[model samples]
Each structure stands twice: as C-alpha cells, then as structure tokens.
Target chain A: MTAPLLEARGLRVTRIGDAGPLKVLDGADFTLERGEVVDVLGPSGSGKTTLLRALAWMLPDAEGELWLDGSAAAEIGARVWRTRVALAPQRTALFPGTVADNLLAPWRLKVRHDAAGPDSGALRRALDSVGLDDVALDRDAAKLSVGQAARVALVRVGLTRPDVLLLDEPDASLDGDSAAQVASAVARFAETGAVVRVRHQRPDGTATRRERLVAGRIHGVGDCE
Target chain B: MSEAAGVVTIEWPQLLLAAGFMVVVGVISLRLALGLERDLALATARTYVQLFVLGLVLRWMFGIDSPWLVLAILVLMVAAAARTIVRRAPDAPKGMLGSSFVSMALTGFIVTFAVTGLVVQVEPWYRAQYVVPIAGMVLGNSMNGIALALERTFADLDARADELLALVALGASPWEAAAPSVRTALTAALIPTINSMAAAGVVFIPGMMTGQILAGADPMKASAYQIVVMLMVSAATALGSVLAVLLTYHRRFSASGVFIERGLRDDIATARAEE
Candidate 1:
C-alpha cells in the first residue's frame, strides 16, 4: 500500500503569553493522500493558518510527528522537505523586482541549481493558469494590485511543483472571478496526484475532504462532494 | 611646579571658573522652565566625579610600565563597552552581548595597535598614554556601530519576515533570505562614520586634534595624527558592524531556513524588560 503524501499526529504549537504558554494548535491530527484537495474551514483567530504552517515545518516551536511521502519529516532535511511541501502564505510578499524576476527567484536558489530555468512557454502557461496574461510577467511585481499580487504569489508557488501545497487564505484578497480562477488553478495543479491543503472561511466546493477547525482543534471531517 | 613640555595643567581657579559656567547654564535652564535643571545638575556632578576618578586611574596606569596591566585595562574597557552597547540596543538578539564584545575587542585591539605601534611608533607599543586613549576611541565608536547594526538588522528582519519566508519557501538558503536586511543594516551602521570622515576638517575640529594642539603639539603634526586616527576609527567601525551583523543575522533564522518567530518575539520582550 502506498503511504499518504503527508501525515501529522498529535501536533501542537504554543506562543508565550503574559500569564503562561498559550496553546495554538492542540493535538491536531491530519492525513493527506495524493490527488486530494483538503479544505480546513474556520473563522478568524482559529488555528487553521497555524496548522498549515506547522505542517510546512515553518514553526520551530511546533511539537509533533510529521511524515512526508512515507519518510519521517525529522529524517528528511528541511531544505529538501520544503521543496516537496511548500506553503503559500496569506499575505503575498513580492520581491523588489519585475514579475519575471519574482517568478524566476526560486530558480536562483542553490537547491534548484541542477534544474534549468523555466522556458518562456512554461512561464506563460503558469501565468495563464492564474488568469494572468503573458504581459503580466514583465511588469513590476511590487506595483501589482492586491488581487494581482495574490495571483502572482499563487503562480509563483505553483511553478515550484511541490508534492503538497499548503495555501493559507489564498482567496481572501481575490475577487469572485479571480477566486474562481485560483480554485481552478489549484485543481489543475493537484491533478497530478499532489495534495493541496487550503485554509478558508468556507469550503469552495473544490475540496475532496472538508475539515472544520475550532479553537485550535479539528472538530470534524467529511466529504465535500 | 612649572608646566611640563607636553603637559597643560588646569589650575584650580580655572576649573572653578568652568564649574561656574555650568552653574550659570543650570540657572538659565531653571529660569526657562525647560525641566532640565535637575538633570543638568546631576549630569554635571556625575561628569565631574567620573572625570576626577578617571584622571587618577590613568595616572596609576601610566606609572605602571607593564604591558599586562595595560592589556587588563583594555579588556575592562571592552567589557564595559559591550555592556553599554547591549543596554543601548534593547532590540538586539540573545547572544548579542557576546557578539558585540568579541567584535569590539577584535577590531578595537587591531586598530589601536596599528595606530600606536605602526603609525605613531609609541616607545613601548603599549604605553598607557597613547594606547589607552586610542583604544578607548576605537572601542567606543565600534561599540556604537555594532549596536546599531545588530539592532537594525534584527528589527528589519522581524518586520519583513514574510518576505524572508517567501524566499525560504522557494528553497533559498538562510543567508540569501537575510541578505537584504543585512545590507541595509551595514549601510546604516557605517553612515555616521562616513559622515564624520567627510566633515572631519571642513565642518569642525575633532576632540583628539584639539587635545593634541592644547598639549603643545605642532598643529600640522596633530592634524596628521588626527587623519590616521579617523581612518582607524572608520575601518574599525565598518569591520565591527559587519561582523556583528553577520554573526547576529543567522540567529534570526533556524537551521531549517525558517524565520524563528520566537526569536523576534523574544527580542521584543527583552526590549520591554529593559525599558
């Protein structure tokens, strides 16, 4: 049997409070199989985003056991693990350069040295997947509108082609049409047996499995269809 | 006793006249209700007592011909400077005191020795008169530079954590993610030294040059010494600030190329505690 793409057991996160340690995610357990879209629904101040970040290994203080692609996350090096599991944060932060530079920024990393730069055709396709035209690639990424920046961020992360994508409120800044485009783009990206976990206020009907988070714990899970 | 060849002594009456001028300034502050009268009085008293004690200490240090004693004093100065920097820059990270101490000690000793031993050719190479003052100048300036660099780099990284994490998510190394903030901090830390270098002769006379002139040194020779001192100071400040920032920047991120949010939060907590 093939192992799940990502699995977490007894994960917990805490922040230092004036009184004591404040628990953010308490014993949050989850599993994601290939070709699955998991939507974690919660209102504001819930632990939806924190859970996603913990799964991405972005929270150093997080405590739990995480397995990625049948290997213990602790056994896998962080740089390699991150390449397989990427987190596209809620707020889109663009570098101080053109969209082409922002999109190609990942290729400049040492880990991607063996991989060649994405061709123009691939770049155009990635942008087109997110409702952005080829012309958007040359514009200044920093000057893009909030919605445009969010889409650019999505495209940028999508081009990395990770096995699992953890998106935190990807549609929070997007309009209805753009949100639809993002949903479809995510679906296309996940069609290759990759797992996509999204944190949203409400399920967008694209998720195969829906989980509700309340006060730092998962309450229930059900099929979205 | 008559004034020595290179010594200019201030008589008691002259010192009293200076004290009277300070009293006049205090009175003026009080009359104007600037709310500085108490601070002015306390500061004047502290300055008087500290300088008097420093004079005695310097005299004792100069009387001793041992290089070990001079080294001991220099170590003490570096430790004091490091503590001052840590206190001044409350936003500095956890290990900042150690980093600042090492940076200041290394840069301060190198530059001071270069000036006293090579440039000025002081007789014993560790003469308290020359080495002590030069080392003090280098340590003091480099301390400020290191503090500024550490504080600015940490604060900037914390503020732009999202930008940094984005790079990390793209498989960039921790160094690559933090390069922008480090560059900004280094530039900021060196600006004061650069400005001082630019305005050295044109803007105003520096304290060291003025002291040499008042102590009966030739004006041209004093100006030359001042130039060398300024160069050493500029070099030390740059080196110290860069070293401190590089050492402290890595602590802002974990080994996994993730920004240590707790590190930034701890820095804020430390700043509040200091306040």
Candidate 2:
C-alpha cells in the first residue's frame, strides 16, 4: 500500500503567555491519505487553527513526529516540505498588488525555481474554478472583499499544486452559494489525488472523514461520507 | 592670528552669559507651562559635569602618545554604545546584546580606522586627537542606527506576524519572509543620516565644521573635513543598521524555517519581567 501523504503522531503545541504557558494542542494524532478530505470541527478557541498551523510547521514550539511522503519532517528541508504541504491561513493575507501579482508570488520563491508559474489560460481557469472571474487578475488585491480575498487565497494555493492542503476556514467569509463553490473547488482538487484538511464550523458535505477538536484534543474520528 | 592657534576664547564671564541665556529659556518655559524647568536644570547640570570630565580626560589623552590607550578607549565606547542599542529594543531575542556589540564594534572599528588611518593618515595612526573624536562620532551615530533598526524590525515583525507566516507557508525561507521588514528597518535607521547629509551645507553649519573654524582652521579646509565626516558617518550608519538586522533576523525563526512566535513572546515576557 502507498504511504499516507502526511502523518503526525503525538502532536502537542504550547503557547507561552504573560500568565504562563498554555497547552493549546495535546498529543493530537492525524493521518491523511491521497484523495481524502478530512474536516476538523471545533468551537472557538479549541485549538483548531493551532492544529492546522502546527501541521504546516508554522508553530514555534511543537512536539511531535511528522512525516511527509514517508520522509521524516526534520529531514525534509522546510521550504521543500512547505512547498508540497501548503497552508491557507484563516485571515486573507494578500500582498499590496494586483491579484495577478499575488497569484504569481509563490512562483518567485527560490524553492519554486524548478517549476514555472501557470500560464495565463491556466490562471484564468484556476480563478474560475474558485467562482472568481478572469477580471480579478487585474484588480487590486487590496480592494477585494474579505470573501473574494479568501477565494483568491484558495486559488493561489491551488495554483502551487501542493500534495497536501491545510485550509483554515476557507469559506468563513463566504455566503452559502460561495461556500458551496469553494467546497466544490476543493473537491475537484482532492479528486486529483491531493489530501485536504479543513477546519470548519460545520461539515460542508464534502469531507470523507470528520473529527471534532475539543480542549486541545481530537475527540471523535469517523467517516463522514 | 596663527592658523594653529585658537581664535575664540571664552572666559568665566563669557561662560556665565551662556548660562544666563539657559536660565532665560527656563524662565520662559515656566511661564508657558511647558514643565521643562526640572529637566532643563538636570540636563544643564549633566552637560556641565560630563563636558568638564571629558575635557580633563582629553587633556590626559593628548599627553599620552600610546596607540593602545586609544584602542582601549574606542573599545569602551563601542561597549557602552552596544549596551544602549540593546536597551532600545527590549523585546529582541536573547543574545541580542552580544550580537549588537559585535556588529557595532566591527562597523565602528572599520569606519573609524578607515577614516583615521587611511583617509586622514594621522601620524602614529591612532593619535588620540583624531582617533578619539572620529571614533566617538562613528560609534555614537552607529549606535543610534542599530538601535532604531532593531526596535523597528522587532515591532514590525510582531505587528505583521500573519503576513510573515503566510509568506513562509508559500515556501519562503525565513530570510525571504523577513526581507520587507528588514528593508523597512534599515531605511528607517538610515533616514536620519541621509537627511543630515543632505542638509549639512544649506540648513546649518555642523558642529565639527564650526568647531574647526573656531579653532582657526581655514573655512574651506573645515568644510572639507565636515564633508568627509558626514560621508564616514553615513557609511557607518548603513553598515551598522544592515548588520544589526541581518544578525537579529535569524533569531526570529527556528531551524525548520518556522517563525518563532513563542520565542518572541518569551523575549517580551522576560523583558516585562525584568522591568
């Protein structure tokens, strides 16, 4: 059998505060296989976002053994590992430029030197897949509405073609219709053998697996569809 | 008057006139409710005592013709300057003080030595008069640059944590992720030096030029010295600011290229604890 695309064992995250250190994630274990969509449901402040960030290797202090493509996380160079396992954060973080500029940003990174950016046609198709029109490429990214910016971020990450995508509330700002469009886009991406993990308020009806996070631990693990 | 001889002499009576002017300013400040009288008095006292001690020390330095003494004094100045810089960025990571000291010392020594030994070619290379004053100017200005750069870099990183992490998630190395903030900090640190250089001739006569002229040097020669001093200062500021940012930027990230938010939080916490 093929190895899981991403795996984490005994993952723990701590956040130091003025009051003292807070244990945000407690020995959370997870695994993602190709073409699987895992939905993590949690209430506010339940360390859902923290779990996503820790899996992306963006957390400052985390204790766990993580493997990507069967290689130890520590052995994989950070840039190389992140290029294959991308995280779209909760807040829409776009540069001060046109949407096209933001879309082209990941290509400018040194780790992407071996890979060329999508052509104009491919860019337009990626935008359309996320319910965005081609006109968004030229529009100022800063002027985009929160929902539009979130879609742009999703599309941008999709353009990178990462093997594992960790999305934190990718539809938090969207309306029902727009949220469905984003879910469909994610579903299409997952069809191409990419593993996806999303932190969401409720199931979007696309997840194959569902887990609820409560007080820094995963409480339930079951099949969704 | 001989060119080497001092042209202006200030006797006790003349000095008293300057003190009277300060008192007048203090009285006006009181009338305006500026609440500067106490601070003014304290500053005036500090200026008097510090300059008086400095004058005696300079006299002794002039009498001693040892290069080691000059080196020792410069080292001491760099140490004090590094301490001041570190104090400015209380939120910086641990070992920032040591890193800043090395940066300031390296930049300070390079620029001061270049000016005194190479440009001015002062006999004995480390003449107390030339090396002392030049090193003072270099260390003092470079200290300000390093402090401003460090403070700005840390604050910017903290404020833009999300943006920085987003860049990292996009496959950026820690250095690449911090490029914008580092550029901003370096620019902020160098603006003062750049502005001073631009305004030196038109806005005002700088202290070094005025001092040279009052000491009976030719005005054109004094201007030349001032120009060189300004250039050296700008170079030192640029070097120090860049070094400071480069040295401290890596501390913001982990070996796995993750931005260490906890490290920064811990640093700020430690600073607060100390305070």
Candidate 3:
C-alpha cells in the first residue's frame, strides 16, 4: 500500500539490569498505512511502549531500521521525520510554558517550526476541533489534568497534521467520555489517511485490533479487529 | 611569668572551642540520619578523620613553604573535590566523574589563578597560605555546585524523558531538547553559592573568616581575605557548574541523545551509607 507511511523492521529494545540484557522489543515488524490504527495489545512487561516508540522514529536506543512514509529513517532529517510522524506519548507532557505557549509550540523550533506552524486562525481551529477554546491558551500547560492536557496535546500535534501518529496508550487516565473523545480524535486522524498508530490499551479495554504481546512478541494479530 | 613572655596562651582553649562546634554540628546532623544510625556514625567518623588529616596537611604546606609542594597540594585539592563530586553525583551519566574532574579542574584553576595572580596578586602567585585556602574554598564550593547541578539536571531528565523524546522527534537538536531542562536545574542548583555570595557580609560571616580571627589575624585583614574568598567562590561556582553540565551531555545520553538512566550512579544513599 504505497510502501506504507511508516515501516519498522528488526526492532529490539534492551535495558541493562543486574542480570543481563533484558530484551523488550524482539524482532518486531510493523508497516503503517495512511489513517489506520493498529492497536498493540500486550500484557504487563510486554514491549508495547518500545514498539510504539520505534514507529515514531524516536527510539534512539532501540535497535531498528525505521522508515517514514516512503523515505528511509536514515535518509531524512529529524525535523522532517518528526513532522511526518508525531508521537502522543501516553504520559501527558505539556511544554513548561502557558497553554497558548504550548499551542504555539512549533513556532519556537528553527526547522519544523517555520514550515509547520499554523497562523493564529489555524491554531484556533485546531484547538476548537479538539474541544479546546481560546481561554485555555493562556493557562499554564502544567496545571491541566490528564484528559484536558491530553486533548490539548492532541490539538497541538494536529497543528502539524503528521502523516503517522504514534500514540502509546492514549486512552489511559481518561474517564469513559474522555476515552471516547481521545478515541474519536484518533479515529479522525486515521480517517484523514495518516499511517497506523500502535496504541496500547488499559487492561480489559477494547479496540478494533486486539494484539497481545507475550514475552516481547506480538502473538495475536488475529481477527480481533 | 616574665614580662618578656607576655603572650596569651589560649591555644588549647581555642582548639577546644572549635572541637565543641564540631560536636554540636555532629549531634544535630545525627537526627537526620537516625534511620540509618550505623551508616551515619561511620560517615561521621570518616568525615572527622578526613578533615583532621586535611588540617594537618594544610598546616605543613602553609608553613614550611615549597612552591612545588604547594602546587602539588593544590592539585590534590582539585582531585579530592572531583572525587567528592563523583561520590555525590552517583546517578549522573557514566562519564560524570571524569566530566566533573576535568571541568572542575578547568574552572577552578582559571578562577583561583585569576583571583590570586591578578585580582589579589599574592607576590609569588602560588603562596600556600593564599593558594591552598583559595583552592580549598574554590574547589570545595565548585564541587558542591557541580554535584547539585548534575543531580538535578539528570533527575529532571529522567522524569521528563517523554517530553525530551517528543522534542527530539520534532527534529529539535539533542542539545536544544536537553538544554532547557538542564538549564532549569543548573540555575536552581547554583543558587546556594549565589546566595552565599549575596549574603557574605550582612547575613553572616563565613568559616574562613571565623577561622582567621581565631588564628589571631586582625579582624580587618580577615575581612579582606573573606571578600576575596567570596569573589573567588562566586567565579568558580558559575564556571564549574556550566562546564560540568555541558560536558556531562556527552556521557549521559545515547547516540540519539536519549538520556541513559544508567549513565551514572546518582542515587548515592547507597555509597554515602550502605544499608
């Protein structure tokens, strides 16, 4: 499918513990088409995080060859690679500045900021789309709750309109309604024809594709979708 | 007593007073480490032994002066300070020790020499009396500043790895991503030294001053030395912190500039006092 928007091959993540190298992501391969959501299901200790991170081209320590869109990971600059694939980390990370400050985030960057930053109108539209309004722009990004902040982050990433959104357990910390909101936003992104997102799930939660990670391997890509 | 021997011999009394002060500090500090009493006791003993030994060496080097000996002592002081930083910042990046050593050496030498050679101009430029104390003060304070700075920077990095990763993904340079977080910590950690410098006079007199007065220096002269000491500390603290933090980036992060938590041993409650 047009070489997929994102591709990862032979990805492995390791952490040096007292014992030895603890392999986390072992030989995981994933190809992401435009606007598809590939939920990565795994029990605790599975390599869900490592796999999602690899797809974002942000896993510096993970062993893998990641390609973005049709370009090889090594061939593209980080700014270009990132602009194409944005990661909505499960952890709510708001820039230390104000709400408006975070909304205007890309404007601070020398490379991606110049090309990707939308004007004020564009930013307002993105925030409004994410159910945020002009009032949130002035608030301290650090002060928001997980759900509110996550939505704001979604809006922020949407400003860039990445070709592939790498979301790691994006549904976490949200109430039923917020989870639906987060899911809908993600669904909207996928519908726009971006590449796949390797999403992690809270236990007993539901998604279109249920793939469990056992011993660092994706054992089930079955008909759960 | 002869009229010719009209000297106040309170040497023992004076030394006892200083010993009393040490006891007071030890007693107070013990409370904080009550949970680990054995470790605390050992650390206290080690500190006493180390400081007393340092006192003897300083006494000799300051008196029977040899330039080579003085320089050697200064080098030893820098080395000791670097080692202290390594012990203090166990959780930092791997090259943290070497980074602390080199950067502290560079900054300490520059500031201490500049103050002695140009600012204060001790004629020999390496007088043990001046150089030793200056080295001790500068090296000691700089080492502390670096340790605090390094610890704060890396801890912030650990907690905010996701933020850092996001920034990196956005094509932000590795330095750019880590710099702000590191800078926040570096600035906060430097405040103690800065506060000391700011409060040198009105708030309280420093240890060097109190020591000089007890050793029979004129109060005015002691004050002068202190002013110079505070200046030296200020310069060394800033330079040392900035350099050590900048150099640490190389050791603590992966090729993609990801922070390696195992980069160094920062949680030194283990080394400081074993369970």
i-RMSD per candidate, Å: 3.2, 3.0, 5.2
Best by lDDT: 2
Model 2 lDDT tens row, A96-209:
789899899999889998888998788888888777874557899988888888898888888898888899888889998889998898888898656455555467778888
* Regions of model 1 farther than 4 Å from truth: A16-22, A193-195, A214-220, B1-8, B262-275
* The best candidate in terms of DockQ: 2
Once model 3 is optimally superposed onto the true structure by TM-score, how far is the C-alpha of residue A91 displaced, in angstroms? 1.7
Instruction: Classify candidate 1 by CAPRI docking class.
Output: medium
Tens digit per residue, CA lDDT, model 3, B89-141: 66675556677889888988888888789877888877887787777788988
Give candidates' CA RMSD values in order.
3.5, 2.8, 6.0
The most accurate candidate by TM-score is: 2
Report chain A TM-scores, every model: 0.93, 0.93, 0.85
lDDT of 1 by residue, B136-191 (tens): 89888898888888888888888887898788877778898888999998999999
Q: How well does each candidate superpose onto the true structure, as a TM-score?
A: 0.92, 0.94, 0.81
Query: What are the per-model DockQ values?
Result: 0.54, 0.58, 0.38
